[model samples]
Target: MMRYLDHDHDWLVAHGAIHTAREIAQQPRLWREITATLQASAADWQPWLNDLLATPNLRVVMTGAGTSAFAGKTLAPVLRERTGLRIDPVATTDIVGDPQAWLDPRLPTLLVSFARSGNSPESVAAVELADQLLPDCRHLILTCNPDGALARYAAGNPRVRCVLMPDGANDQSFAMTSSFTSMFVSAALMLGAVPLADAAARVESVAALCEAKLALWPQRARQLAIDGFERVVYLGSNGLAGLAEEASLKLLELTAGRIATRFDSPLGVRHGPKFMIDARTCVLVFMSSKPYTRRYDDDLYAELVGNGIAPQVIALGTGAGDTLQVELADADDLWLALPYLLFAQLFAFEASLAAGLTPDNPCPTGEVNRVVQGVTIYPYPN
Candidate 1:
């Protein structure tokens, strides 16, 4: 009897909708705020980032909790090539669980914390543990919640620098949409790649494309859900592979585990993991725009079609292809990530509804949260 557009769940529906239109409409405002933040604070940020880069033993650890963690994973490859620095995308969960193995006391390290709340126990604990373990370590906290612990931790601490994302980049929704993309953008710019002036056009173009394309994604996803696929296998490569992980998690979380999902690189799935595919599963491939990358993606595409194991298969990228293909118009992989992510978010939202759950609060059981919960922080003795 509950209608999807019922007023009772207005807030939930509003927040859960991650269409191309929403993202595109937000482009101008988000980019303006993002660029302004860097321009106004470049003098201060540049020196700090330079200092971190100057260290010969500098190990840039991109970290966060849940969706926040995926932001780093999505950027690690691009950052490595742009900065030519050793960058590792480590989860704060893993870091908090075992500090010694991750934080070598001998290595002078830089912990780049990507937190939406900046207050996740794991986020706070990872920073504290790193300082306690590493002989020489610096903290760069990037988050939307400025009042959260991570942002304020930089106060009076010369070793820490906190960069806050633009307003609304924090996302009021249960899921991270614009917030995830903006933070990744800030990191990519601050760490390396396109200058502020040059970044303008690309950002505008990508945002515009999203707005134009996102309109029909939700309907498409909803229809797919109606087909009743019980499982999903998402495949991508490099940066997109990390995105595949986030996409998989979103469906699992939003469906309250009702829709089992798994993700792996294009090549990695061909291994033993291929067994997960069956007639009831939906296979989604995020093909790369680059020719070299697309070759691998195509190979997997061909394999999946050949196997004819899954009931459905969707391929998304920058070119026309057999089967269901979403060809992005001449955009880099980084920009391509936005539209791809929107598809994932829409799919998860549809799945949540298909399972008769609220998209905004998929798990009212309190097992998960918009910002996480019930994590006890232990004191790290100096």
Candidate 2:
């Protein structure tokens, strides 16, 4: 029997999950390293970042593919509120398909590109398109792979600055674990309101909280997995909603579609997506740390419990009596998101194991790949 966080390498390899499990377990440590990397390199990027922020009517576009894209989605709202910049989270998939639609040449653009491998055709294509179309466009490439095409593209480019994540963040598993959170934390430190000193302190606290959650959540998550829920629904609001989307994708990817999953904001769920809930569904709600937002989150949590539709309903946050509680007092939504996400990652990993799927390469038949394959990039008409 494979155990969570305590299994031998032989057992993990036997279960075909050593890579994913190790990557998941290494996140907190990697997050601390990311914090240090960001601090050490602040002098290199901060001046350029400050100058960019000073520009009037600057348009910041955060673009990436798949989970990388969700990093942008998760941070845009809070970054907009904090920086007062007009920020949009567009996917490279969308940009590559229709660059003219997403890239406005009229505004001075700062394209923040997030990528794990940084070599996805769509990711490289989007950057090339931005350079071609925008009269004044700057690139901030955050990637785990230092040797990736995107990183190489930024070399000695006056208009571009690239930040490489810590080693080991380039996840070996089919799914993104450390790579995702490291990039997310890096962006928050680089762009969010938290100053470098405060950001490092916050990351330490959040990492500690995650370390605790990683230790405690597996048993509960495994139980939920063993319950054999046919579907999973993840809910949150604002930035957490974007996180909910990532959480949903993690479960779906880890299970290799053995479980159907959906994600939506707490209020948005009432619109129509709530229909996804059924008796066999497991609902995981990422509760907001903000008191005002928590009101909405609490209401939904009560409603979901009151309905009694889902076999298991988990509330993950700093709230009292929550199923997965991490009491991060007065933490910004961005920081709180880290621990919340760690819980989601752990839950998904456990669920994948419980479903008898190989978390390392859930789809070994080449249907889905760690790095997406077999795509032909077409030239855009000038």
- Against the reference, the lDDT scores of all candidates come to 0.79, 0.89
Worst 10 residues of 2 by lDDT: 1-10
lDDT of 2 by residue, 1-382 (tens): 5454656778889899898888888888988998898788888999999899889999999999999999999999899998888999999999988889999999999999999999999999999999999999999999999999999999999999999989899999989989999899898888855788887777788888878877777777777788889999999899888899999999999999989999998889999898999998999898887899899989999999998988789998776778877788677688888888877887788888888889998888989888888888899887
List, in order, the clash count of every candidate structure: 1, 0
Regions of model 2 farther than 4 Å from truth: 1-4
- Compared with the true structure, what per-residue lDDT tens digits does model 1 show for residues 1-382? 2223222234444655433224323644686578667867889888778877988978899999888899899899877877789999999999988777788777788999998888889999999898888889998888989899888898889999888888777776566766777788788778875666566666667666666655556578888877878899899899999899989988888788888899999899877998889999999998887789889999888878887878788888766664444554567777778778877877877778778876667777787788778878777666
Structural similarity to truth (TM-score) of each candidate:
0.90, 0.97
Model 1: lDDT to the true structure: 0.79
What TM-score does model 2 achieve against the real structure? Answer: 0.97
